[model samples]
Target: MKVIGKHLTVDMYGCSFDSLDNLEFIKTAMLEAVKEANMTLLNLSYHKFEPQGLTALALLAESHMSIHTYPELGYAAVDVFTCGDQSRPDKALAVLKSFLKPEKTKTTNIMRGDFGSQKDMKPRIKISIAPLRRVRNTSARVWSLLRKK
Candidate 1:
């Protein structure tokens, strides 16, 4: 089997509510994690939801990393995917864990771009009707209009 990249998905439970809800803290932690993992950051985006919760994403040269938090549930979901050996996705996850201080964590590692052989590969088809940005903008506009009523 040939592997091209590593993807780590983490589910953190019993995390600090304050830390999960803090947008600045999450942004800072993500930046630190990117640096620690030796990943080149191309862009970063984050949003804090009304009432609570937060979401952040970092676009890296190697790949991408993201975090979504539910403060009321004391949980955070994190994803780190990196191509090439120079970047450490595990190290990035570690940095997030340190900041959130979760009492329990469940992690899964997936090897990306791994295809054993022609016979072993299964054919699959995916279709997208609209770009993500367009969907998001439309949804936001609808939500805003509903809230104004």
Candidate 2:
């Protein structure tokens, strides 16, 4: 099996509350990160919650980047996943750190795709679906018909 991508997850702590809660700032920061990381940005979306907090997502050609903020806790969770050898997810993380300025961070790096040889692979789980049942009220019926094979 071949390695295909890198996924970086960062738990940023003690970040600036204002920066995390600011939707516009997060938008700009995400864009800057994408540009600096050399990831191709296909689309960007964000939502600001009532009261506080925000969530932003960037759909990229390589993969995607997302950030969820907790202003009350002065924390933010960020994820950057990119496929291919040329994408630099670490650079994107650095860009976000510079803008958010977290006092402490816990970062994790994961190499995605199958990393073991074929012989070492575990057998996949197989699921079998039971036959559909007729009901008088089909529209409101709930189906519980899956079983492992």
Clashing residue pairs, backbone N/CA/C < 3 A, model 2: none
Q: Which whole-number lDDT from 0 to 100 does residue 65 have in model 2?
A: 99
Candidate 2: list runs displaced more than 4 Å: 115-149
Q: How far is candidate 1 from the true structure (C-alpha RMSD, Å)?
A: 15.0
Clashing pairs in 1: none
> Worst 10-residue stretch by lDDT in candidate 1?
116-125
Each prediction's Cα lDDT score?
A: 0.93, 0.89
Provide the TM-score for each candidate, comma-separated.
0.77, 0.77
Q: Please provide, for model 1 over 19-87, each residue's C-alpha lDDT reduced to its tens digit, 9 standing for 90 to 100.
A: 999999999999999999999999999989999999999999999999999999999999999999999
